[model samples]
Target: MRTSACVLALSLAAAGPAIAQDHVHAQGAHGGLGTVVFPNSGKTAAQADFIRGVAHLHSFGYRDAAIAFRAAEKADPGFALAYWMEALTHRHPLWGQEDLPAARLALSPLGASSQARVARAKTPRERAWGGAIEALFAEGKEVDRARAFADSMRRIADSDPADLEASAFAALGLLGLGAQVGKGITADDAIRYAENVFAKNPKHPGAAHYLIHAFDNPVRAEQGLPFAREYAKIAPDAEHALHMPSHIFLQIGAWEDVVASNERAWAASRAWAKQNNLDNAVLDYHSLTWLQYAYLQQGRFRDARALIDTARTLMASGPANARYSLWDFWFQYASASGDWKSVSVADPLSVDEAPDAGAAFPLPDMVQAGVAAVSRGDSARAARILSLLKARRATAVPGSYSNNGYEMGVALIAGGIARLRGDQLGAIAFYSAGADIEAKGSPAGPPIIPPVLLPYGNLLIANRMHSEAVRAFERELLLRKNHSASLLGLARAHRAQGNPAAAMQAYRQLLENWKRADADYPPLREVKAGASSSPGIILN
Candidate 1:
């Protein structure tokens, strides 16, 4: 899948503004794709420089590319390709910040004659600039215009199946348009028809990645699992295959399987990175980061620690650039370990501005109002507002619609606030609503955001459903590894079921791990405070 906008924005934001003195800057100054300066290539050093900047963009090098492209445009006023490349650079996942507007701005300057000339071009190189512009419309959710562009690209690619570059670029545009409109099946059909182009030429740029995403849907994902595995076998060194397997394991809550798949990917990819000295710092950080979670899941605190130590070492060697998303992972791991200090330092919610769409329901204020109303023992008003929030979650955009985890988390927060307000039944009602969402698969099952499970499991334990609570905690622990609250929940459930030894064991482990870990856990600060010193059990 194309990197999500959120990932792009977050990565860029974390990386901060570009640093000027890096040795790496010069390497990216020259385009990786080597230029073809034909006679009348209209090619100046400025155009070549701009195209080099465009090449850097393929690997999330937006910050530096922006500088080069802008300078190139300044050098040559009538350079349409500069403008075109500038526009394409923003289509990078990082461009999500201001993509729709940037796309419109890029396409605005092309004269009618220029577009017409592009449309009539006999060769794919002549048309690459124009086709890419149309793909931007598709990115912005403009369906009709996107479809026209896809049709044009398709015709050009079909005309010369032997021209692999044109075929690959055209395939990419079609796949992108398909994804935007949720008609990815059209992309699947088109790819199957053009499979010969790739069969004859395996190393075509973008072809392999585009085919993997566009054709690997629900039905085909399962049917093509064999081929995916085959791809792994054939390209034994490929990191792309690793992402799919790990993600699939995650989706099914196969935590151990996820660990194994990620390990293989880490082994294969990291070996390549270290050997080539190719951005090993950032990639190694993430690899070990995943390993940390995997270790934590299996109750291997020592192993988890080693992995985290490795990540920190690699990150320290880098330019200290990046949003340090690795910090979020640390927070999550620490939270599971019951380290409130970690939570305080990292402040998980520090970056969590309530999503803009939440304005439609006024969630922060509404949650606050509802909490306040319940504090005054006004269950009716609290219920009304929460119900409104729930409805909005149900009806939002499909892609934007968060899973039950967010709802579950919200419900838990609301319920806790209500309980503090001295309205136990009101709290129970909210918990029950969240539970219903979880059971109904609205929040979804398996591969869910792990933190969301804590409150739901705690609510189950509070309500005296010992087995259900244990299962909930177990399911969550499967994903999280060392979740402190889950361990606490398991302890409580065991205690409730007359398993004193198990309960004591779980509680001791939680306390000991939290004490030993760095204390940056982001999720369970509240729950840990509530249950930390309490010995036996609190079913209420």
Candidate 2:
């Protein structure tokens, strides 16, 4: 969103005057917020608050950072950098969102105009920093603002090689540019910039955190492990830093690590909210969903189901994403466990509790009723669902991660329809298209559920294309390591292809992966039976 000159002027004029007041906000040690060296000329209280805000900013704890920055403003009204950092918090380019009006308002109190704000800076470096952020909120399209900010930040970082904070901001601006203009620039370029900072300070929270985002893919997941291992430790008090390690853990197939990471994140978020006298509705949902998926992967069906109740309880009053996250968990559980019989039967929530269709988040697929209709071979309903999926995908920005995600959804629905009509060849073609799409944007977006490869492999095996099925399942493993559903399909494909040894190996791996699973989980029992029957198979 662009705030035009006229709009910005009116906003500034309305802001009228700058008044500094003392308040008791942003207090607390907030210890372990990683390391940063941002020297400023504010008074002692202002300096402490500004440094704390920088720490929160590095960890992507924007709200907390804003509070800290506001506290600094209270401590020292003339601290130009505090409003600058507060303005920065209002713009989240990585999340593809920014409150342009709120951002302009944040700056309005700093000065009557951009040039005035820069003039308020006590140092040339601070002036440069202020100019870069002002360009970010400049009058133009979002991409133009990002490009301008990236150019300005690049200059700032170049001007002072010793400025670690400048280098970090430069890297972040580039990342924002990537997210704003999809498929043009990417996180890869930003990763190189962040790598330089990381080399100098391994404990820098932003450097470590950005590296994890850049390396969130099967090919580079191991590379992210170093940063992921240290980020939470660097900022153990921040909810986002604690949760971020799971991104690498999920990509690398570290089930236990994913579980542990999200568990701590969810708990910390709740603890912070309660301590601050906030409602539970402010708790983070991203980690909650990841935690639920980790439980399903470990075959903890009861635990996964419990989250469904939690999701439903919050859908009525929690954040807008409550419905979307609830449905994501629902679809993931049903598909992963292959327990469709208990899907609607055991679910405590009614259609109203978690509606299949809503204005909530605009998820393109995973309409519970639509998937059910496909399963029941209701051709008319399936076609309607497919049309809706295509329409949703069309609305997504081209070459964007969401575009690819919705495209995959459209392909899956088409494939499901083909399978329902008994066109095995047609079904395989659609699933293959989905697999191709999945491979395109895995590194950039929020996780895509029910990986396209799972159904593609199952269809290949159904067609007696055993070797092709093996390749498909192998690809699935690369995308999501130790996926039990894919593992089962891989074992079956191997057995069908007369590779008894390979089949036995896959089964043993499945058994081990499911060691924490409930004994009553049917898939675990089946894998155990197969392992027991195969004498040459190694099982511990």
Candidate 3:
């Protein structure tokens, strides 16, 4: 199964690799691929594919970009810029992943060195751009290479001030350097460069797409909405463009927008995969995952569940990461719907028992699955899960995502184990320690399971800590607005604390959030019946 842009770049790509034949797939499958004004000296025959390739590259449509760039190379064999973009197809900046060997291989057909490749270019700007792309694949600490790349990009943008493409690429270089918009330095610089390009060329896919990645945070997601909205329409041929808007929608709790965007993206990906005779890896499972999560947020429980089987089937032959996404669908449904019966192939509760059982960030969903076992008096299973978490923690690189996740998981599950053993204070200590970690938000960005806050809140309620439970639920809601579980917990805790008005307000908001929810959803039934915490069972 081909991995990377599930969909092809242009309609002519329908013919696959021989896209250079008379029906060269260059001007986007749809003519609305967006306006890019790059005046490179490559032959006119190569420009269409080169422009399309640059657009796809901006959208992170790495595979399609590779196809288009290769088409450009075929059209004009000495188009060194074509080779430069093709090399970039192997380096996914936003994902923090790269294939240096593949990038070097892409450049090999052009020349043995960066200088040799630049010598093939017809103009100074083209030569300068060549140097920047060379630095992009250079050997050094990733941070240092990123800085070098950005520095060269800065020089190019400055020299060819009229080239919006260079400015957009410069903005991307800043992002690759971890620059945050408005945070100043390279940070302030990225926003200015991208925004400048965007203001001039609103239809430029690269400018819009880079701006979205630049401003995707809770504080500034609103700033990305304009670009996010325009990007997909500008490049409907690219699945990543359709899916990229959700990063903003998610930040702003725009669940309906997220649902709509990913629905289109996943469908496009599915169609492409089917046409290409590829399995799960060709499908946009990431968009599918986001679509399912959006369904859950909207209380469309049945719809969300329907997607899990589809996810598992489509991603069946995919790699561990893809299979983990299937597991995510399973875990999200199970967590949101409160279904604690059994495990599927994604087995949250079932231990791998393999010696190499981890890429390790002891999934919080797995932790809660163990807690569910404890709820059923399965101490042995809980202990096994805890032991696995501890081992995962031991293996984690300090301050990495895995390290943070495992550290967080250990605390929450240890709290559960402590509670199971009737060590109430010990349980509180563990949960409290985990709370401290969550507050830091140190690993950066968001988590798949959101650090298991609602369960912790539920645990507090089970222990009769009404005030703390209320605080926990509020904190969770702050992290993600209108979270149904957090709303339910908040409602319960408020009632327990003798704040009927506050409880009622929360219940009303929850009901509004669930206006279209599955009628018989367990939480819906509970809230309808004015059901509060049982003082014994944690509604985790």
Top candidate, metric lDDT = 2
- By TM-score, the best candidate is 2
Q: List the candidates' TM-scores in order.
A: 0.52, 0.86, 0.84
lDDT per residue as tens, model 2, 1-540: 221111111111233431221212222568788776665546666766787898898787888899899998999787888898999998888766698988889888889999999999765666777899999998999999998998887786765545566778888888788776752356676787788788887777889988887787777889999999999987888899999999998887778998899999989988887788875566787788888888877888899888878876766564555225556666666766665656553221223322234323354344444565566567677676666666666677876776777767766778888898899999899889989887655542235444677789988988999999999999878777777778888988887888887887888888877889887876675677655655443221
Scored by lDDT, model 2 comes in at 0.74
Q: Rate the local accuracy (lDDT) of all candidates.
A: 0.49, 0.74, 0.73
Candidate 3 or 2, higher TM-score: 2
Residue pairs clashing, model 2: none
Query: What would the per-residue lDDT of candidate 3 be over residues 1-540, giving only the tens digit for each residue?
Result: 121121111111122331111212326553456777666667777777887887778878788789889998999898888999899999887775788999999999999988888898665566777888888787787778888888888776775555577789899998888731222336568888899888888878888888887777656778888888889987777788888888888877777888899999988888777766766665677788788888888799889989988876655656545235666777667767766455464454457565346334346666656655665567777777878777767876786655777777777777778888989888888878777677655221224634556767887898899999999888777666666778888999998888877887887788776777888776776565453333232332
Model 2 weakest lDDT span, ten residues long: 3-12
Worst 10 residues of 3 by lDDT: 3-12
- Where does candidate 3 stray beyond 4 Å? 1-26, 179-188, 317-325, 346-402, 442-446, 528-540
lDDT tens string, model 1, 1-540?
221111111111223431121111123423232221111122344654564454344223454456666676677554455565566655543111336667556545544444653554323344554565555554434556556656666665565454444455566556555645544446665575336444754432234444555444333433333333333333333454454444333333345655676788678666656755667443634444555665565455556655655566666666653434445455445544544242222222211234344445333344444433443456665555556556556755544225354475457557866776767668667776765555443211122133445665776677787787777777666554444557767877877877766666776666554543434544224234434555533443
